[model samples]
Target: MNEGNTALTWHVDLSDQKLPRLLLRLAIPSVIGLSINALQQALNAIFVGSLGAQAIAAVSMTMPIIILLGAIGEGIGVGTASFISRHLGAGDEAEASRGASTALALAAPAGLIMTVALLAILRWVFIALGASPTILPIAIDYATILLPGSTLMLLTIVSGFIVRAEGSTRFSMWTMLIAFILNAALDPIFIFLLGLGVRGAALATMLSQIAAISFYTGYFIKRTGTVLVSISQVSLRVDLIRQLALIGAPATTTSILAALAGMFLYGATARFGDDFIAAVGIAVRILTIGALPITGFCIGSQAVLGFGWGARDFARVVKVAKLMVSITVSLSVVYSAAVVAFARPLVKLFSDSDNVTEIAVLSCIVFHLFFGFYGIQSFVTTMLQSLGRARLSAVVSFARQGYLFIPAVLLFPGISGFSGVLASQAVAELGAGMIALFVMLRQFAELRQGARDP
Candidate 1:
């Protein structure tokens, strides 16, 4: 399976490849692409930071909302990808194509409805999310432009997942790279040269999304890809949608819960001050950037895992799981140590305010204390999702941010003040990592037994 040969080969026999070699081939491009995307996000904050801490805070406030809406597309994408990979593994290309078309069908209307619904209550939602009086107007300004254009963003996300489902990660990587490059180039021009401020940032992101989706559209239309999707092939049948929903709903819920958790964290931090909000926001971006490789690895492993599970290649699945978990854990430890050591310099990149820098450095250190454990939680969750174990996946996914982190954030602050707030996520990571490890061990045992039985 020469992955470099991208001339109209739609499906690759993922199970035929060596596990380590294949995983690296798929994951490297994704890591580079996602890392660049994360860097662009950090750069967006740096560009916006010139306006003031309040401006940075305003942008930070909108993240939860953006994530909440984006989760819809992500859900569709995950479900679609899972379906496509499994069908392809079973040597059913038609089913894979149907899954792709159905995903697009679902994403289009969902994006539109989300835009309309969110626009109606934009002000109130931000306010409830802990935007102060001064930050409220700025937050609204940013969200207004970003929210309405979310349809483009949604389309790009789903399309990227669809491309990757067929083991075309290079295409997925190119789309993301194009978007990141375009967004990075456009950010300063729009934010400063065009004098659009935060709204300009929003515009730049939308334009980049337009570029990404355009590539995807061309890929599908020309039938130059693994899955051939056309207008005539699109289906809205009840069973098909339900099949997608069953796998997708849990993934969507996981993200939505994280978004809600962000809102809750914002509310808790708000009482401390806008500086706290700004600091926390910066730390969040830093964490996101740091975790990109781990995310990329998990995402890259998905196609392989899905195909193995679908084909009942239990031994292959087990091998992939062990290798993935070990590599991700090692990467996380290295990144976390580096971040903790260089927290000050990284925080200073986004803000010059001594107060903001000080708070942000602290936040980064505490948030990443148990960060290595996150690799465990993330890989297991991805494995479960790839295996279509939605119920268990959701439980593991929710633990890090939802049930565990929420209570820790709410109660810890009262117990130990601001430091407690920073520690909440670390505690949650440790607990969730344990949960994931327990599940992984049991899952591997079951797979081993299955392999012997048949």
Candidate 2:
């Protein structure tokens, strides 16, 4: 079949195929792609760690800002994808194309705005996040290089969404894979070979993201018939923007809240010392390597759910949700166990300092013990997004990162000190998981009843 026919066939299969087969077909490439990206980040930390605790802490400090920017991009991407998939499910190719085009058109401006905003508030944000004086300058330097490249990062995510909306998971995966491979090759060369230190890591990352954006732009141009992005089709339609924000706002909040939680965690940890900051930073990056694949699966399955729900195929929605939740939770268990078992070795990869190693190892084990709960929450939120239940998704998403976590981090630390800080995450995860489970069951039950009645 030609590319256009292939894209249409994929949309048909999303609604027609068995849930297990469809989920795997869509989810696997995304999982691999996200996993490689996470690995590249870990490697970056490992390389940058050699410079000292200040460098590591600086990198850690910048994470929340980076995440907030990413939240915006991915939020738009997810909302755009949801809109497109729903249209495709209803066999409205023209509407789907319009969403694809509008999302692409918005990417650059959105990115540019984020760049300027982050740059203007760089110092204040870091200070509020509890960066030490020694780490502040280093953090500023890194952000300077990275903020301008926000345009590329945002567009890359938007492009991924467009491709995946057309059921081109492999194409999306390859875009990330190729970029990550290039990043992996460039990190050491920039950081050590050129002696650029922290700035080198930022430069390497920014360059890699630009490459990803170029690849995505080329893909769309080459496959124009499959994934259209025309200037004429772009519009500031109030309804379209509202629909995007309805889902995208809460989705973005989920990540922004997560970033806020991280900032809070960093501030709390900084009280102990800079080494602690560095240690927690290393542990979080390591944890990401495992957590991202589960998220990738959730993200990948969004298309499947959107198609089913838009087609009013409630049975398919339920089946896909069940399989995805089960698979992700199981994977989280295995991943958590492995990380805990090799915590010391993993920490060592990033640092040789005994103090940093001890803290990172303990943080690694404590933070991941409740991995199953985190995975459950992620699965439910993604399903909610797919069902276009943004409010409920927002509620569940808030619980994991902001609602429960903020209170737990504040109160628990006073009660138990350092251990309390570590345990607070597990507590939040458990609470959020229960709430997500309740909401998901309720939603799915209603969906099934509706299907039976009609």
Write down the lDDT of every candidate, Cα atoms only: 0.87, 0.85
Candidate 1 Cα outliers beyond 4 Å, as residue runs: 1-12
Q: Can you write out model 2's per-residue Cα lDDT over 45-98, one digit (the tens) per residue?
A: 988899999999999889988898988888888888888888888888787778
Question: Per-residue lDDT of 295-414 in model 1, one digit per residue for the tens?
Answer: 888888888989998898888899999999999999899999999999999999999999999999999998888899888888998898889899999888889988999999999988
Q: For model 1, what is the alpha-carbon lDDT of residue 258? A: 81
**RMSD in Å for candidate 1, one decimal?**
2.1
Error of 2 at 316 (Å): 1.1
Give each model a TM-score: 0.97, 0.96
Give the TM-score (vs. native) of candidate 2: 0.96
lDDT of 2 at 335: 91
- Candidate 1 TM-score, C-alpha based: 0.97
Model number with the top lDDT: 1
lDDT for position 158 in model 1:
90
Candidate 2, residue 154: CA error in Å? 0.8
Residue 282, candidate 2: C-alpha displacement in angstroms: 1.5
Native-to-model Cα distance after best TM-score fit, residue 337 in candidate 1, in Å: 0.8
Query: Residue pairs in steric clash, candidate 2?
Result: none
